[model samples]
Target: MLATLLGLDHLVIAVRDLDAAAAEWRALGFTVSPRGLHSPHIGSANHTMMFGEDYLELLGVVAPQPHNEALRAFLSAREGLERAAFTTTDAAAGVAALRARGLAATGPVDFSRPVPLPDGGGAEARFTVFHFPREEAPAGLRVFACQHHTRDAVWVPTLQSHPNGVTRILSALVATEDPAGAAAHLARLIEGTARRDGAFHRVATGPGRADIAFAPRAAIAALARCAEEALPLEGGAGMVLPTRKPRPPALASGTAIIFEEAA
Candidate 1:
């Protein structure tokens, strides 16, 4: 049987300075988690901000290794929402299904990191992940799948509270030269469909899941009145979060985060 495509797992922001990025997130009213170091092969580390079912991660390469060459390359070009991961229960099967569909989805790679707790104890958060080739992704986007083996270690109760009152992601945006084509391609990559509303190509993931949209990078740049190259793919790497109260817009790594009041 073909592996089913689950909803979004988390969004990753590739940063040059791990601690500074985490600090910025904290200052933005998020309750950030302590840093976690990945295996040497991966050569990366991260800090996370949990939001109930999903979360956001600030990823940085701490040690150079073969496995993290792509991540290093991403950091060289820019820093922002570098990758987006979808949830999957069976990563091995997910790869096979992608291959059967003629997509070159890579391994169910296993990795883990130590999660520190407030009670002077720690746990390990393990995961099996697979990747879709960059060619299959739309412009300025990288997509992957992740299967969490230890969910509690990640969604710890103490880290769930955010002073900003943000509860969940409402939508994610992608900018491409050809949004119509990109939207269709994105839907196809994630085993979904897309519908066009004006310049936006919207893909509804599911109930309680963030909606994804693709638009023209040039148009977004024009509307923002900034140089096209000023932002990553014309500010395509943006997300909407519903907060309990209004907060001033936050900007980091050229990505502007606009928080809105909860409905």
Candidate 2:
């Protein structure tokens, strides 16, 4: 049985230089936040350029020439949005469902470690993640997710400063040639409904939850322009849902996110 997954969390845009890409986000009016170095575990270091509770994480290889294989593969794809993240209640069960669908999938990988605290003490923050193996999903549609041990309050500081009009992620705009097939496959794995709308496939879960719209070449190109800087990818390009409001200037090149909240 497929485990119950909650909603969307974050999205990743693969860039050539983390610093350069982060700079673009800063130029667009957000108080870009700190960088998190997740080494020895995820194989690459990333700096998050924050906006409200959501963020645009600039990820790159920081080690030797072409340092990490996974990072290299993502960067080599060249200039575009890379992956979309979904929130799940059970990472282990999510993995099992993907495998049952015949897609190459991996663990509810854990990220729990002790880090120095401000009080001169150490604390542990735990997390879980899962991903769709490259061999199975198309280059661009690779799906992965992360869940932190911290409460929504402790970890989501960006939300406090988020402007009034902004709300949670409504949906992601994914560009895939096989919209119908992708939607069908995803519907089986996720707790949502997928519908074919011309060349795009729109997928969404509960009300006020995340939605993903899969488009083709032209649409993808149109959305890529919204990115502060392109972070080439192996698959087609598109936008992640619930962009920061006043909307990042970088997103000017993409489609506007539309949705309504419960009264």
Candidate 3:
């Protein structure tokens, strides 16, 4: 198992139309960041909804490039929750720890994107990402560790206030055929303990304290109000958001997001 301490970073939602997706999120009462273009080499763009330390990223492919072929394919197949990233202070150490556990990691690759600041200026947000081998990652899930070089540039207080009354992310729900097996794998990756709760297995990482639950296929389908086949095999099926009062689950680009009353 990896030894690095990981915390929830952000969730990615892939969309076909960036403008429409942003507008939809706004209508749902979220404050979204201005569109940010990835480095010219990456061929992608994103708009983010900031919520304290963790946020939601709406990703779209603006240009086709070999480097972003995987993202392009994900968009072509369907649009919804595509990836979940965790935070690490030292990405190199995190990769080393994963490698020590016999898990293949690609790199602590450094990248940056220009983000439009609320004050009408541009600031560069830098990041280093450590990726796991597709085969070793959780089934139907794309997970990675991210180390931010410029935190202030990404999480501005002015952009975090949302009209939907959401304060923070609580959990990401994953539907899988084998909840126990999936939970075990995620526990190892996050270096956390997994416990069974009925048909769901919950793994809680430190600091962020957000739960990642692996639920039985039927249970998740019921929660999402959709057919089981409509959900991703092992991908994020829904998200739990903390709100002042209970709000019904909302569907965005095929992903179900539940808003629960904050404790």
Candidate 4:
């Protein structure tokens, strides 16, 4: 079969403080990768927590540039689940598919970051990405598709093990004015289907991938109370929640997280 939308690839949290964010996730028991620097054109840096089939990225703008203009604005408003990327085997094909469906998907933009290897070496983790129209996605949230060219440089086994035993992102909870509309838009972007259940609209990415639920703020805020804590953009942890700074839907801004444990 030709390339298809794989599933939820990773969740992105934009933080004003990358080092502090990295330290926080590490304290939460995740083995985050060393900071990866993007090309000058992008002017961003990140650290990632690798999982079996997905990961979570903490991104920050280290320099001002045209490419990260939207991201900078996101950080200004709040720092929390800003974007979610879908995995694709072929980025060009994925963009084509989205266009075929009448969505104005853009890019097969390629970039790379240097990764410091455990064995005192380094490798470049390269990627190609296509973005769904910003106006089409929920306000303050970005959705896109990604294709990885250097899996080994990324999905490093050592980085996949977390002390908390959290395995992967289970779901994302988004609070929006129109749950069904938001959920349907995201489902279409990921090549999934959405179903409405009362105040929530749920989008399941695929088998063994993250699910997204769109709901009203009150409905999502109720779930947040059960969590140990929530950060606007830093709400990713599993099994054992963070030792400090927790989430509630309001704190998570537009999206809250639901994690899984299999340590």
lDDT of each: 0.79, 0.55, 0.82, 0.72
TM-score of 4: 0.85
Model 3 residue 95 distance off true place after TM-score fit, in angstroms: 1.7
Order the numbered candidates by lDDT, best leading.
3, 1, 4, 2
**CA shift of 145, model 1, Å:** 0.3
| Model 1, span 103-217: residue lDDT tens | 9998889999999998999999999999998677666678888899999999999998899899887767777767788777778887787898777788766557777777776
- lDDT for 93 (candidate 4): 88
TM per candidate comes to 0.93, 0.72, 0.93, 0.85
User: In candidate 4, what residue range of length 10 has the lowest lDDT sum?
Assistant: 234-243
RMSD of 1: 2.2
lDDT winner between candidates 2 and 3: 3
> Which residue pairs show collisions in model 2?
78-232, 79-231, 79-232, 80-231, 80-232, 140-235, 171-211, 172-211, 226-250
Which structure among the candidates has the greatest lDDT? 3
Residue range 1-263, candidate 2, lDDT tens digits: 13545655665666677677666655554344444555455555565533333444556666644224655776665644566666667778778887777877777787653443344554555678887675545335666766666643224455224332434454566655566767676666564678876667877754445566766655554544433234222253544434334443134212222323323
C-alpha positional error of residue 63 in candidate 1 after TM-score superposition, expressed in Å? 1.3
130-186: candidate 3 lDDT, tens digit per residue? 877666556466788889989999998888999888878888888788989988988
Off by over 4 Å in 2: 49-55, 64-68, 100-104, 112-124, 152-154, 158-167, 220-236, 240-263
Show model 3 residue runs off by greater than 4 Å: 227-230
